[model samples]
Target: MEYGQPQASTGGSVVRAILSLLPDWVEWTVLSLIAAWLVSLGAVQVWRRIQYCRAVRAGRPIHAAAQYGQGRGADCLGSYAPPRRPDADGD
Candidate 1:
């Protein structure tokens, strides 16, 4: 290459150019999605904390084996069961 010639585009320069062309709404949409995800995560944590507090107040065993299905599968608890999809099996 000649000394006066321009250099080829690097990965960083290409990415910066692409990002500069995106509309403002695209950035806002991404920020909104991130915010929603964070809020949902916080809500889940709060729900867990409330449940833990209730368990303590009710004198429930937090680590009891029976709570997690004793010696059988999780479905053995009867309170919780996974929904079966009709198309799960290739019947």
Candidate 2:
């Protein structure tokens, strides 16, 4: 019975006791890992789209973006390979 000071509660606060089992730092670490995974997933999708568009414009096979000339042949406008001519021998 102290003046101006609150007496300790006789009844147990069960909810608080349970929450103290795990530290706050562990929760924050898990949240950060999940956020990073989602960001990387979005970035990978964007990169694939850019490669697909380049392949279509260059007239290279759509399925293989890497086959398109990695050299200077491609520009803003496409530089498709010249159409093949029929061989003179007709082989």
Instruction: After superposing candidate 2 on the true structure, give the runs of residues whose Cα lies further than 4 Å from its correct spot.
Output: 1-21, 65-91
- What is candidate 2's lDDT per residue for 32-90, written digit by digit as tens? 88899999999999999998899899997875434434433333345565543566222
Task: List, residue by residue over 1-91, the lDDT tens digit for candidate 1.
Answer: 7999777679868966776788889867876998999999999999989988999999988656444323446445576766646774422
TM-scores, one per candidate: 0.48, 0.45
lDDT of 1: 0.74
2: Cα error in model 1, Å? 31
| Clashes per model (N, Cα, C within 3 A) | 0, 0
